[model samples]
Target: MQQDTIEQRPDAAADWPDQIYDLLKLHNIRQVALVPDAGHSRLIKRCIADNTMKVVTLTTEEEGVAMMAGAWLGGDRSVLLMQSSGVGNCINMLTLSSIHRTPMPMIVTMRGDFGEFNPAQIAMGNATQAVLEAMGTLVKRADTPEDVAPTVDATLRMAFNTFRPTATLLGQRLLGAKTFGKD
Candidate 1:
């Protein structure tokens, strides 16, 4: 696919989560585990609503990781969707990612940056990138809606090809405050 072939303004097509679905479809990712966030609620809902993709809602981020790992071992491509704060919660399970050599891609919606007014999200938001990096993730930050599809596509391709985990930081700058928009 051409790198510049993406819509700039938000539409049904510019919906970040839908872009996720398109990328997964392109990658043949038949199953996925999701730890829903307001940031990803629409996308997760879309995944669950769509019959083409198998969606597993997880209680915690670690559960998502474990489930995706199992799917990968069974010869299916999978993705984990979660907010940045969940990264702190899933540290232990993250070790399994490296130990098993699971090359799944994680799409993380960053909080506590840019327009963030939440004091609670500060720790995880600040530490989010560092934590994932420490855990050996090849990270990329998408600062615009148009950037999301290609970044995710590239990250998934890189992770699968290298057999290493990859993370795409869905930065606050790109998404702004609200999760859903019709722009």
Candidate 2:
């Protein structure tokens, strides 16, 4: 199969995705929850193929939130991956982490902010950061190949240390805008 725009991004060659996967292992995160998004393809594949990790493919982003809650309750470290558009779906569910102080770590691949082709995607992507902040999520961003490891490592430390809901947004600048086939 051919790679998509996200996979062909220069950062992919730099292997920020691998750095993220390594950090996940370093943190001993045993569970990976996500819905399919091209920006996360490599990392998702890595987590799925790793026997030490249990990857949960969720139908919606909110389900990952609930599942992470359960995973933490069961004494396993977990993280969620989704696109900027999906953040809207988890608005209410994020309360689970905020009110209870659960360690919910999320990696969101941003869209609609840079070279976005789909006008529909621009709104949520534009609002994701502010909305997540309003909902009490500690949001960080990784906008370059060099930003991946440091941002993710720091977000993980923050989330696990204080049980705060944290997210590291893989910005459009980092993953490149999904320009599929437009001019």
| lDDT values for all models | 0.77, 0.85
Q: Compared with the true structure, what per-residue lDDT tens digits does model 2 show for residues 10-56?
A: 33345888999999999999999999787887798899999999998
lDDT, candidate 1, 51-109, per-residue tens: 87888877888887788789888988888888888888877787877998888689988
lDDT of 2: 0.85
Task: Give the runs in model 1 whose Cα sits over 4 Å from its true position.
Answer: 1-14, 177-183
Where is model 2 more than 4 Å wrong at Cα?
1-12, 177-183
- The global Cα lDDT (0 to 1) of model 1 is 0.77
Candidate 2 — which pairs collide? none
Candidate with maximal TM-score? 2
In order of listing, the candidates' clash counts read 1, 0
